[model samples]
Target chain A: MTGVTISGVGITPFESDAERSALELATAASEDALDDAACSLEAVDSVHVGNVLTEALDVQGGLANAFVSAVGLEGVRADRIENTSASGASATHRGVEAVASGASDVAVVVGVEKMSDADTSTVTDAISKLTHGREYVQGITLPSFGGLAAGAYLDRYDAPREALAEVAVKNHENAVDNDIAQFQKEVSVEDALDSPVVADPLRLYDCCPMTDGAAAVVLERESDAEGVHVRSIGSATGTHAVAERPDPIEIESVSRASERTFADANLSRNDVDVACIHDAFTVLELLELEEIGFFERGTAWEATMRGETARDGAFPVNPGGGLKARGHPLGATGLSQVVELVWQLRGDLRGDRQVAGAETGFAVNVAGFGNNSVCTLLEAP
Target chain B: MTRGTRDADGLRVDEAFRCGDCENEWYYTRNRCPDCQSATFSTYRLREGELVAYTTVNVTPPDVRSANVLGLAAFGDVRLIAQMSDDDPEVGDSVRFAGQYELREGGEKRARLTGVDGDG
Candidate 1:
């Protein structure tokens, strides 16, 4: 089996106050990645741009073609992916497939989001539309789902809010070394528990902040590759409305996608060295770990409490911090996850933050409250 | 609500349609069955169910003056997303509707989930 290899990865600093436009952020990352790959714009055959709510947030559309034109890479086959938060991973998967299918020799995938330009209320309303407007989300906010889900998990697992606070504390501590991370200061469990209630049982610290940034990955055939080989990319879709599912606690799409990716790569859960499960909400991290088969059901919090997910633990998760501290710019988040995995697999992380002797790395990018999922597996040579 | 829009004032009724072939039921309006892609459907009423999940949104849209408590209520095989009347709704608490909560005139009017008669 053969898959495209990542030759270069680039990212803009994830922050809440990035003044740059979406196009500017994307072009900068694309150019940086091409430079890192030692390739020219002329060598690129296709462009994939991942963006969410650009038209609503930035008043822009036709993102892919416009990006190629602005970056002086016109006439390349270009496409835009809009799978909400998973847009970046979706675009990367498409880029990898393009090279693997012989449609392009070299492809560039850029995920960007410029959300700081809008008001907080506007941003909140925009995200709510991700669910069914008429029935589920017109008046309801996105964090409402987090609050409801967290409350249920606590009752079902016999866990307390302190368990969720540990995730915020750990990720915040990990972000101290990540220069581009939005929050570099470490927080204590008390600070998280005492934070103002955004939704009952879920404090402000439990949610990922709105962010602005971009990241890029360049994929080429392995014969001309210079980085980690994408062992497999698997995707699956669940019921559109989260409540419609029989089991609200389990995300069937993530499990199915993870299983397919591991199967395609001929690997098992035990073989994975580093993993990045989406942590838009602290409770989501615990559930994703369980749903992805990294841990037994209702036991991920114990692992986190035991320091098993730390950078030096048995299997480090989100060593460069997660969406919790990394800042989630929706579209850019998926690519940022891939960028971190590439760094970990290449031993590019510094200090103890870097995992030792990492051989296999994995990541999952979820979209629109687990309605869709894209799981990618990378192998180190 | 246009022509053929039926209403039951006594009980909260959501017009649902089930696929005649696959028995896939949905509360909202849809052209085809998501499962079997069947066009033919039988319309029915969804009256009452239990709360699957809920939350109180402290920060809401500007139009929503007070904190909006929302709920995901299950009626048979389908779930309805709506503004819930119960200030503190348990996961499995029975929820029925007393009246429509169309607070805004032109805004979207979704279903309302309220504590049933017997359940507190």
Candidate 2:
């Protein structure tokens, strides 16, 4: 196992109507995390901020230094990491390295995104531009990729369309128990099917909403303190052009990262009790599960349809509602997933939502529709 | 026709590069071959391909048309992402590069594909 231990975690509510600036949100989450770890500002040796689109949308820069001053931390190393949607996990990787290498005694990583004030068109345009320049000019958005992949997957496997909607239905139900979820309410299969179509064969419910939030975690060398151990983190990058892949449904980034992570940690799939997958779209949840070796190719959809991934199922997935329900604030989503897993491993979750005997948790955060991905494994102390 | 000096937008919609070392072809222009790391390349134009997958996008960016259709087409060993001039193209259908059109506001004219009749 890695020498890094997660001492504390904190997350602000995921909301669409953000009333606070990104700096304020980040400061608040950092304060909560430091408080949880009983870590004083003077003890933090480094701070890494995971953020994207804030400077573009809010026209603000030096976010790391800004957060350092806001939290009253001085003489600590600080910087920002940007990797599209996987920025949080990348920052966490840096934090873990700092402590694992004895560069710092304690490190705090905060990821924040505030885009509620921006107009919908501006946000959509910015996100769409994440694709390759050629594809962007062709007007291909992330949801379009989801729709294309979903259609191909269904036709190739002869899977029922209801399987896709079932993912949305289940995630929405899970969100009902998640107070911090953006859409903390249940949605029926019929409701999902009837929802407005954003991309063909993928309804509005199939996609994650644009959210504003921040999540933070404090890391230190493994100690006797009550915390979760950072087992390992694996990352990989695939073809930049989505169309260039030989197989449209194959997410090389997820599979490669998962393989490396499991192998590096000397762990097996059976060891993971719960998972927080990047379900930016419902189709992605099934695709990633298969890619991660949790289920066979062309079979995760059926498993999902049979309720095998529910909170009470043998293999629980997205126990914290997932991005489809919890919300996706781009940069903050990866760290939020870790926060959820940390809480689950620590048995901090309330009734019904907690995995009864959860000791190991897995999380995968993807960037730019699987152009790159970072997989994280956390174990109970 | 090979015009190595032309910019992406100025080049033909079907324009692409082939590595001299590995013969790897791709749509995006790169100084060196991604597969063989060869600096030598030749330009080529793709006129036909097979539709691999497609989607009808209803929630589009502000600059794009509503209900814009996009598709991934396979040309020999290469793949290209382009707009679909026709909405009813099926996967595996033989498609031809129809031409180019402005798919987004303030964007360069990009390629468009259409299903060729009598070809699956």
TM-score of chain A of each: 0.98, 0.98
lDDT against the true structure, each candidate: 0.84, 0.88
CAPRI-style quality class for the chain A–B interface of candidate 2: medium
Relative to the real complex, the DockQ score for model 2 comes to 0.60
lDDT of 2 at A244: 81
Regions of candidate 1 where Cα sits further than 4 Å from its true position? A136-138, B1-13, B21-24, B103-111, B118-120
List each candidate's DockQ score.
Answer: 0.45, 0.60
Query: Scored by Cα lDDT, where does model 1 land?
Result: 0.84
lDDT string for model 1 (B15-77, tens) is: 577899999998755579988999999887777788887778787766663577877788888
| Model 2 Cα lDDT, one tens digit per residue, A1-381 | 778899999899999977898888898888999999988888999999999888768657889998899999998999999989899998998898888889999999999998785888888877776777667667788999999899999999999889999998888888898878999999999999999999889999999999999999999988734689999998999888888888989999999999999998899999999999999999999999999999999999989988999999988899888999999988899999999999899999889988888999999999989999999999997
Q: Which whole-number lDDT from 0 to 100 does residue A200 have in model 1?
A: 72
Candidate 1's residue-wise lDDT over A321-366, tens digit each?
8999999999999999999988888888777878899989999999
- Model 1 per-residue lDDT at A15: 95
